[model samples]
Target: MAFKHKSTLLILTAGVFSCTPAWAASVSVVGLFKDKAIVSIDGGRPRTLSVGQTVQGVKLVAADSGSASFDVDGKRRTLGMGQSFAGGAQPGARQSVSLTADARGHFAAAGSLNGYPMTFLVDTGATSIAISAAEAKRIGLDYKAGEVTGVGTAAGVVPAWRVKFNTVKVGGITVSQVDGMVVETGLSVPLLGMSFLNRMEMRRDGQTMTLTQRY
Candidate 1:
């Protein structure tokens, strides 16, 4: 028993001593409302995060001035107000990024909104951006997953459910915590509703799409 205890102590000591400089530390930040910022880590090690990059297991500390930072391998990388760290790396940092595609106007891009992969079909006629029953189910939505509720359609009352999106981004525009609806009437297509379109400047022409927004 004494030998076992000594071995356990040694193992614990190694664990504590082996904490890597790359292991991120706890970070704190102050952010301003309506302000935005970008951050880099590990002295910007990877150099840059390209467009449409998915990131998790990362940290972002926001401040009142729209600046933020995260810990990298036991170090803190702070950002300034209105600064951009989205596409490029800083000195001695690991690469991180947000997934943003560049499609404008009435175009389609596959993305994970609300933590689910979906094909967004740009539509101006949709009252709000909408989704099909099949696509909604993949994102853990309750089409058949929950009790059906009433939804009004051009035909009449149809069944629908209130849904939530964990993340929503299009052409560099993003919003979170948005309330959405899942409809079941044999919708062959997932409609890109206004809930997303109202957030951007979309211009469409013959076979071309243009989208513009302020980052």
Candidate 2:
């Protein structure tokens, strides 16, 4: 009788441990709304969660149409739509940058071009990254030596040079061999265009824009 009781206790303890759910290793916000969010855990199917609800160790703390806050494995993380969190990521992991829109609803990013500090205005309309002649000179770029070209602008056709940047970094995300253009005139700020944006997974939520490196 004593041996049977001990065996039963051990089996019950094993069963309890086996029933416990494993902690989630990854979480992605796919949808957000007032007091609700849709999240995917470990690349699984999306799960809809209300504020204060928990799923796969991820608890929704707060949510809105633009962003969502969650308690992920005891860490509070705010994520916009299409943003993700990877638990236990090692150093030098994948990079992502988040930008808030200005009062005028325009997005600007502070980054570097070939190690030179530059301010970039997010412009999806531009075909390539566009910089002014003066900016190129300030960055010590020999833009005139690049292939001569013409770019149309509000001020009409303007002389331009096609150049390839060795490195274009926006926040922690860095892209190499990015195509760009140097306009002789009619350009005020450097434009972050398709040349760089194409290499990123762009996500916009209300006034916030998130750029995640794809490679």
Candidate 3:
């Protein structure tokens, strides 16, 4: 009886992590069909995206189960699910959210708060998510690199400090009042970090990474 009980436990454990194979979270779009959300194309050329919707270039293409096939700019593409879009919401919530990066390591989004549309880079290396001093000026944040503050990085101890951005957007998402430090001086690109990321739907698609915020 003990042996049987042990076998049952193992089965249960496996079952717990193993979700429906149809929607296993995958972050690639080659030859499979995924539930792709088209956001933008031509890098926001032509007309800008309207509010209350995703951009026009977000494509989820793949032929695997739950693979996605859709059109963008009159072009056909295939996509696949990076992860199950279900069961990824707040308790008793009805809305779902997801983000799939393209071959160029870009997750496209088109959204505006108070009538301002913004783009962002989804960077995981940032310790606390940051923006450049210049961007800080744009977002209305007082982003002045203060005394050389010390921070850790893959290279080694580097000079860094905090600079606020007016706003940063990723996965058709946005966050405000975000405080993050710099890695090296004179670098002027916005880095998305986990500081504001902790509230979103976070998951890994192997070499592919995804962040979706469902409100």
Instruction: Indicate whether candidate 1 or candidate 2 has the larger TM-score.
Output: 2
What order do you get sorting by lDDT, best first? 2, 1, 3
Q: Model 3, residue 167: what's the lDDT? A: 45
Cα RMSD of all models vs. native, in order, equals 19.7, 22.5, 16.1
Relative to the true structure, candidate 2 reaches a TM of 0.58
For model 3, the superposed segments whose C-alpha errors exceed 4 Å read: 1-97, 104-116, 145-160, 163-176, 182-188, 205-210
In order of appearance, the predictions have TM-scores of 0.44, 0.58, 0.42
Candidate 2, residues 20-48: lDDT per residue as tens digits? 11232456788999999998654444679
Candidate 1 positional error at 109, Å: 2.8
lDDT of each: 0.42, 0.71, 0.38
Predicted structure 3, TM vs. truth: 0.42
| Candidates sorted on TM-score, descending | 2, 1, 3
Which lDDT tens digits does candidate 3 get at residues 23-119? 1111223222123232222112122222222233333332335545443333444444332121122355432234455554444332322223333
Which of the numbered candidates is closest to the native, going by highest lDDT? 2
Lowest lDDT sum, 10 consecutive residues, model 1, at: 1-10
